[model samples]
Target: MSAAPPTVFGIARLGKRTKDLTKRLQPGDIAIIDHEDIDRVAAEALIERHPAAVLNVSASTSGRYPNAGPRILVDAGILLVDGLGDEVFEGVRDGQTLEVAGGEVLLEGDVIAHGTDQDDVTIAASLEIARAGLSEQLELFAENTMEYMLRERDLLLDGIGAPEVRTVLDGRPALIVVRGYHYKEDLATLRPFLRENRPIIIGVDGGADAVLEAGFRPDMIIGDMDSVSDRALRSGAELVVHAYRDGRAPGAERLEELGLGDEVVLFPASGTSEDIAMLLADEKGASVIVAVGTHGTLEEFLDKGRAGMSSTFLTRLRIGSKLVDAKGVSRLYRQRISTFQLVLLALAGFAALAVALWATPGGQALVQILGARLDALLSWFTLLFSPRATGS
Candidate 1:
């Protein structure tokens, strides 16, 4: 008879929203999410939490496009299982002990649901299929892009609809940070720029937390407020809620609960909060806008899984001339000071000081005292390393 399947055990953690779920995930916990065709950004977040395995209630990769999420998870040594349906949610509860034996999920030795065990081979096959059908996604993207331009032309061309915030951005560069991929690294690299220009800092959604993490308070926080923390919402930064076209603000209610209803300004617009922030900066006459952790590549846009990405594409097209990526700025703006240059500058300053000192009687006396101390230090060093000290 064949041996029974190997049961890998872990604590179950569930969240319907992958972004909110990742915040509470701990090492060795089994993350249960309902993410469909999980994007690279979500995969990266899960990887950060070091989960033992991920069990998805929906498709991990649909082969509609070559999403890098599942591939990233499997390669990072995290076990991925998908398509177990919503039955798993009903069967399992948070913090309960669960067993994953191949494609089957078990609780108390009873099978709850079964799914496909994703690996390098399976994910690779999915990516191959996705790439083969890339042309269709591109065609859809073109259609969406044209439709977006028409719907948002007034705001896109004239910056007509973006609401004004109290934060002053005129004639200065604005740094718009999003809590997306590689944001921490990009923020660290922009330290010099931050110190030099002191650009108006705007954080989108949870990006306010990122700004605080990087040791700066956000000048303004703009987003739907779904992912941001309560601390960030109360962080005293000017809050601009990204509301729907119908003027319904989800974030505003949360602020009201926090007793901050009077402080926020609702800005109704289409597209992602990332687009809203960039537009806001542009409308306020920011000389330049620097984006950190915002979508750039075609795959990234698709990974977002938003029809609003058409708005992002057009948003860039509208302000492409003034907007720059943080990576570009970090690469080009090399203002790092060298130790050798500092030493040389110090020597030059000392020489100038010595010359000026010699011109005055009191200054000359002070210089002589300093010169004696220097001679004594050199002589002591020389004596300490003298040839006579060696037995040879």
Candidate 2:
């Protein structure tokens, strides 16, 4: 079969699916770059692998919109066909031959029947539709751009030290810990650090739970009020509500319900839940802020459905060296079994073996009988006092 000129669609799911349409993309395989936002990392990976002409179904063709994927592709010299929407997918499904001239969809049919309504549709037309539906998406992109701008201004904070590690006497560094999906795992690992009071802890909404679970209370909680629990809200942690671009705080309503309006600080930013938390920590002069289970890569940022990690990316730049990603910290602090525990277990095993050997056949029989009696006795004691047994 002859290779079809690859068309990049803006939707990720479709882009991934297009691989099945062609055997092995030699030169003519059209790259359908799907995704409302082009995934820079995915695009780079795809570009490296296929080297095919790209049909960008994404929202942005110009890098001005902060869609890094498109910008990267354009820079990489990949032939990009912009603004072909669901029709592009239909084209492929029906085995249509697509033609692109100067990043414009010139002709979009071969085997597939082209509809009249779609006939006059230019790249601009598709972009207009995307703009209307994805106005929010563009804003998200813009917010990310602003966030990166903010972080760029504060690049000194990008290290692995507590905020007050050196300057203040008896001053512990400030820590911004995350408690998203990996709260338990992050807490389990961060427990010892909390115990040492290394930094002031700030939790990103649910991260407060992580702090408490790590046996510490968060000095601050940041995010829109949705995911935080009642127990977490009433846990006496200071609250910071992340608001939208208009400064209208969605979290403020929940705070009022909990009578915590006064306690709540409104932070209007266009970043993720985790981004606001770091910003709060930085604004408050936190010496060090550590993030856990926070979105770090392109996929993670996209998985959160955020068009850009603009705020997070910016916040990291703002607190550059001081903002330590928790993944890195976990890798640095991953636990190994202690030698003492190993030694103790070894001794216990030897003692158990010694006792087992000492009992001869008749003695072993007697020992077994005694052990059974002891087990029954223990069970009786457990039944009397155990919470489950006592129904208490």
Clashes of each: 0, 44
Worst 10 residues of 1 by lDDT: 326-335
Per-residue lDDT of candidate 2, residues 170-230 (tens digit): 2347666664434456667776776786676667776676677677776667788775677
Could you give the C-alpha RMSD of every candidate to the true structure, in order shown?
6.9, 15.4
lDDT of each: 0.89, 0.59
Best-performing candidate as measured by TM-score:
1
lDDT string for model 1 (167-275, tens) is 8899999999998777888898888889999999999998999999899999899999988899988889999999998899989999999999999999998788999
**Candidate 2's TM-score:** 0.46
Off by over 4 Å in 1: 1-7, 328-392
**Against the hidden true structure, what lDDT does model 1 obtain?**
0.89
Reference-based TM-score of each model: 0.83, 0.46
